[model samples]
Target: MPGLSPRPEAAAFLRRWREALIGACVAVLGLYWVIFSFGLMIWIGWAVAAAGVVLGVAGIQRARFRAGSDGPGVVRVLEGRIAYMGPLDGGTADLETLRALRLDPTGLPAHWILDRPDQPPLAIPVTAQGADALFDAFASLPGMRTEHMLRSLNAPGGASVIVWRAADPAQKRLH
Candidate 1:
């Protein structure tokens, strides 16, 4: 039973599994709707199926995310606002006003460099507490391709690369 025993330290990582299960269920149900919408209400079925796909994808992505304690500090996201209280740097950035986002993995822990007009860039460690929530928040950005962002995030480390920009140039420059 020694191998079956749980470690106290491992309990923290238990938070990661719940989101994935929910995502899987959503995806399965959505796929069912898509495949079974053969004769009736095809349009509505497809529409709902699409929404489910989005939710499922986002949920799975967030599930796979883990904000370990190795990072400098913690992050909090609430009501569309992103805040970071870190050691080397700390700041808050409004998610709705985000103009650009880049991932910098050159450091020990990766950071999501959030840029907004009239404010300094906020660098929040990707592994900070609540950073997993950013996945859903990020999906709301207009014109962002979900698959592309996910691929970039999983890409090998290198110089900071801008993964997303606001859909409207005016918003990018003004906000």
Candidate 2:
């Protein structure tokens, strides 16, 4: 079972979930203070509290989205032989191996695109640091095909992607 076991990326998703939860809590606290400091009516406080709760829930949902497969860190191997442990509902392309990965920093939530021929691309939203880690890992793999680090887009925290290709240079494309 060489690739049967889940990859380290699975663990990364969980770690991100925890971090998001903590960040959400801090945000909620800040919202509470902002609302209370304004000294609005009791109803306003309740409204603000409700809003915080909604935001917290949204953050949790986002974490779950990322933790699931719908957000980021989702890896699709190939057709009929997909390996997705995240929350996305559909199956993925059956790739023989990872061919090329393109990082798109233009998106509000930066995206990672894995390119494989004859199959729809696999897209995942990733943090700037996560993208860097992915690039490093892919680069270290034996027989990696990627070559250039094309134009640097304005990624959060100045993160850039490492481009890889199987037969030719992967074109810098945004999804």
Q: What TM-score number comes out for model 2?
A: 0.34
Off by over 4 Å in 1: 1-4, 7-14, 22-56, 67-70, 170-175
lDDT per residue (tens digit) for residues 1-175 in model 1: 5578676666655556555556556656766776777766565666666666676665667655554656677777788887788877798888778989887878767788899889888888877876777787777777777777777677788889787987775556643
Q: lDDT for model 2, please.
A: 0.51
Shift in Å, residue 141, candidate 2: 4.3
lDDT of each: 0.73, 0.51
lDDT: which candidate is best? 1
Off by over 4 Å in 2: 1-82, 85-96, 128-137, 141-162, 168-175
For model 1, name the residue pairs that clash.
Answer: 117-175
Tell me the number of clashing residue pairs for each predicted model.
1, 11
